[model samples]
Target: MEYVAGNVANKAGVRLLMACLLAKLHNPLVDVRKPYTRIGGSDSFSGRKYDERYIADFINANALPCNSTSAFLTPAFRNRNAPLVMGLELEGRPPQLYTYVLELLDDVHNRRVEPENLLAEIIRWLLINRNEQQQRIESLLKTLRTTHGAIPLSSEAIVGLIEKHMSLKGTSRIPVLIVAAAYQAAGQYLLEMNLPLQAHNAADVQTGALGDVEITFVGDGKVVTSYEMKDRHVTRGDIDRALQKLEETRKRVDNYIFITTDRIDEQVQDYARSLYTQTDGIEFVILDCIGFLRHYLHLFHRVRTEFLEAYQSLLLAEPSSSVSQAVKEAFLSMRHATEAG
Candidate 1:
């Protein structure tokens, strides 16, 4: 509990721990304390298979993004042939949590503690964690509620807060939230421009969506536009894969945009623009993160406060796995700073 409270920002570790515990709790037939303690042998004993069936589902059920940096992405849990030695020697784990978990598991394996009793405690911990997460989200939602008589942030100040948010160390989530928020905020605004948005939070590839953000009119099944957020520089290969997705979907998208945080590749930009004729008028546009925000802000300056509120709403809605507690508090602080200034 101390480890979790001390490193609440690292939700990956927490998820990993919970996943293992849930895997064990869910499958009583498995005679293991956790995924790392399981033996890798027959179909009945492989830990990897156990994890493959359950871990991603656990993440999705809890609304985690299943990002690559997450322990969910690590292959260590999938070592079906590995046994108790694995946890004993598990290396490269995040600070403190791994060590704490290791000690608990070691006690159970050594017969110093009862596995059944500890598993019960594990399930209890899960409930407690859920409650804490709920409270945190409630707090943020309350902050956004102007009914409490708090001053609403100006559109200009919200932009500045976002700029600061993007610059913060360890908060890589801000960029994605920016795009999602803009899509959400542009509800009536986009409709006024005759281009309604299907403002879906970018689910992981498992959800089988064409891209991160899809633009479509209400009651229309076809996606007219899609935005894919990329942290890396846009590359031709990336475009090729995207084209393959377009071909696979056969959904006839009108516009495909890549909102990248890295510098735009000039040669790649030319390559993308030239594809207009080849793809039969499927326009591909690449813009840096801030540039895209600027264009959106300028286009919707009349309702920028609407955008700010929408962004805050979306930002606060994100799970701790995507946006950490510290980051959320930082946002509230930034809002207060803006209001004071």
Candidate 2:
């Protein structure tokens, strides 16, 4: 039972890790058992220690003769008879020794199970109870939020924001929620700049534009902005493609913002700068994880309690009668993003 509990904890930690990656949440890798960190996994074992004099004497006594490959030792004869009595057989040699060796081999084989089989069994169990496990986790989160003022999150606040500013509900709402949250916060950033928001989008609401999130400033509405939030590592190819896409929309939108969870390389920045100078009417800017968080943190601060609830809810939420390939693809993308991050 102890062993089963330990393995279940390990598997549960892995599941939480996978979920965090899907939600673009950053958490530290933690040691599994002792003094559990924010999450759990085992660290490498420490080196062994022994008494020096006893170890040296034992080694000297049992040391093999130099350059002797044929040298081997045999076990005492008293233990040999038990295997023969246990039905282990010998073909040509004396019955005792062969039987004893066979018995030892059988014992070893019976004592050890294949690791792959154990993992397969554990994963099967997880799949069977995934929904129930998620519900329990949500309940735990709710309890943590309510019982502790130190917990620092409120679903009531998140739900309020969602109800007031967002038209999203259920699983399909989350991606839109993310987009919406970022969009609303970007508006706050604009307001901070002393520019009033002339027009804005409800989360995922778009004007048939190329960007994921859009906002127009109070001034002529010609000073418009669009933000694309990609929770993944930024690459050179990604920058090039974004610049290419921005070129098409530059005639209409004044600013095209690219936000990612990756550290943008200097070369990508240089390329973007070169494009920026070449472009006539539009501004091109790139923001990394820190930058995106600076704006997105507003929503996080507002809906801290319900944020993870919303994430888990969306993860299990299905918008259609059947799960689609796109949903699986999005999850895969987030998984890769987490690994890369």
Candidate 3:
């Protein structure tokens, strides 16, 4: 006799009521991408009836295709959907909730490849600009013997050009780049001076312990001068370490020079001077940023006459056997492309 909606099937009147209730309950769901103007009306009762104009327009207006920095680093290109933004956007009392949004955005934007891009661009710029600068110097060198009006090589110009293209601050790669450039410049200077270089390559600069002696010349099988490049702040402790390391090669080396960035404090300068004054048997010298710049400037002037031609020849001569791998590779690629055409 109990007439529950689900169990009362024997009675015809109760069966009809339950059928209507179930039909109403199972009405088709509304599409979220549509507009629902009327609520609890005929539209609500009807099945699968909705307008999608407003939602589509809203999406089109608000969303934009992300212009990523690097095509290779984009998440869309990697076949991944947009990541969910969890509670990381909220500002907590002590700290905020962990958010993967920034990380996600970074991957989408591809900012990680920026360094290599900048490096490649800078190298191309340097090669072209330095070549032009060398041409100007070549003209001046012709008058070197006759006139004092010859234009001087400006180290500031070179350094300024590099700084203009790339900010060396907060970059870990700048030191290595600068040191490598210095080594290249030094090798060119030696070549112009007609001195026989024992070893001058990327290996000499990159694949060694910091502060280790880099002897350039081997005359009569003895090292004449040992050079060390430091792209950091020179501390007394660093100097002590360098001096200790140099002790191992003191018998073979006649002189030792440490070159570093211009930020050398007075303490370091004083310590180096003291070491130079007190030490015997071998000469010790420190070339701070300014000193090194001046040294390079002199080298530029010394080899100005043959700089550009020599540089081009060197690039084409031995592309694989240089410290400037990126530049060399770029140049070689261009050469190959041109030849292919």
Candidate 4:
């Protein structure tokens, strides 16, 4: 007689095995305060004598309780967590503070809320409680300035900042900036490799050309790799133009690399295949921006350290325009060499 295992028994056995394996697996420990500690000291000033009353009042006003007797005794708070709580609290009870201030200003018939007083109070609150949310917002603003092309004071201020600084409407400027940043990072990487290249430069091939190609390293008198960078938005026309330009310039260089911020299109892939089929001896490649970003994020930290060192050294050197350029040139060359290999 053939006997089949019961469905429940089979399922239970699988679950039991999984539970055993899970029990054996090492649990990962995460340090939520790592990012905060990296930027600023971890100790919250909320427990200090001068801050105690302010914090207690703020917490009570918001219906939050202080479980710890001494604020200083409290564990280092995760910066992100604190701000989220504060934002939620402020958003929920809009009538308490923000609305009160707004009504006071509205009551003034011909007068307005004094800009100085408004700014002073904002600054005071930001400083007094050492508001984690305020600090995080400032940090976010600073990062966005570099990463997003420019900073906005508030979410509502984005349009104004974009209009004033970028001139390009919608998401066009964002992509351009992202592409530029990718090229800059890749160029910096190539420079670190000590490739025989001067510096990266992007030039429009034709007038009214929306598309531009960046050449990180022009072949020096010595033959070396020549790279062309394109963004994901590159079209078939752009690829054809770049190939034509590459062929025109190939004789002047040892090798050619085609890098893009996105995956190569089918047309470009077919063209690359044809090049290999023809044995043109020109190498083609595609570098995704996401991968490039991950690679350079680490490199940027190292570069920052090097930059700081060089900057300090410059303080001791005689001040000269030529000297400054020479130093920059040297660093760029070194970076290229490191990247090329």
Question: Per-residue lDDT of 1-341 in model 3, one digit per residue for the tens?
Answer: 01111121111211222222222334424211111223343323211121122222322243211110111122211222222233323231212211322232233234442323432342344345435534544443343324333453245544443343223232223333443344455564453221223232323324433233344442343445655656577678876766776554444355667766647688777777776555665666667644554456565665432332343344333312222333433433332333233
Cα TM-score per model? 0.78, 0.35, 0.37, 0.28
**What is candidate 3's CA lDDT for residue 237?**
80
lDDT per residue (tens digit) for residues 189-263 in model 1: 565122322233434345556677677765565678877878779899989888988887666788888888789
Error of 2 at 340 (Å): 30
Question: Which pairs of residues clash in candidate 3, taking residues 3 or more apart in a chain or in different chains?
Answer: none
* Candidate 1 regions with alpha-carbon error over 4 angstroms: 1-30, 33-73, 126-154, 192-205
Judged by whole-model lDDT over C-alpha atoms, candidate 2 comes out at 0.38
**What is candidate 2's TM-score against the reference?**
0.35
TM-score of 1: 0.78
Candidates 1 and 4 compared by lDDT, better number: 1
Candidate order (TM-score): 1, 3, 2, 4
lDDT of every model, 2 decimals: 0.63, 0.38, 0.37, 0.33
Which ranges of candidate 4 are over 4 A from the true structure? 1-237, 249-263, 273-279, 299-301, 304-341
Ranking by lDDT: 1, 2, 3, 4
Task: Measure candidate 2: CA RMSD.
Answer: 23.4
Write down the RMSD of candidate 4 (Cα, Å). 25.8
| Candidate 4 lDDT over residue span 197-299, tens digit each | 1112224443222133333343433434444555454455655665676555544333444556556677666665555434356555455534543444445
